[model samples]
Target: EAGVAQSPRYKIIEKRQSVAFWCNPISGHATLYWYQQILGQGPKLLIQFQNNGVVDDSQLPKDRFSAERLKGVDSTLKIQPAKLEDSAVYLCASSKGWGQIPGGSGNTIYFGEGSWLTVV
Candidate 1:
């Protein structure tokens, strides 16, 4: 039972450059999500994927940020023409279902060691 996996644990780029992050969710998980966390704020959901289709992305910045889950498995998130505000940790998380948490009735989201991004 492995947790989610992410790469390029840290990244730094000048504003206007492009960056991408990758994630591979745990096996048997049915839902995946991408979140953005600025230093002083809690993580904000950027995108949600149920299987290979997008469940929600209303908060995602369409002009520069994009994400996809392939074949209901691996996922990727990209940011182009990066802005200084985009400096944050990109977190990848997954869950089994609504009642899958241990000793709890709610889903337990498992998060990856976030991909840290710094825009200069």
Candidate 2:
């Protein structure tokens, strides 16, 4: 079986510039997520998608960050007019179910190599 997350191992962008990241989730997985991890801080959820529908995006910077899941398969995350604070690793993750939910019995989530970005 193939791994849960794949491709787009890294990326770097200048401040105020735009950049995008892509991910291909594992087969049969129903939940996908994008997270941002800055130096010295834990990963923060940027967005969460169930199939092709958005489940969460409250933590995302609406003016600069955006994401979409296509046909319940692949996903893309983009940052426009990125800020210096956006310098970090963009991680793509997936799981069979959302364990974050109460008593959901979700499986262990898997993360990709992550796209690294630097606002310069």
lDDT of 2 at 114: 85
lDDT (tens digit, per residue) of candidate 2 on 4-118: 5644566666788998888888888899999999989999998999999999999999998999887999899988989998989888999887656675654788888888888
Each candidate's number of clashing pairs is 0, 0
For model 1, name the residue pairs that clash. Answer: none
| Candidate 1 per-residue C-alpha lDDT over 4-118 given as tens digits, one digit per residue, 9 for 90 to 100 | 9998899999999999999999899889999999999999999999889888899999999999887899899999999999999999999885344577678779999999999
Model-by-model lDDT, in order? 0.93, 0.86
Model 1 TM-score, 2 decimals: 0.92
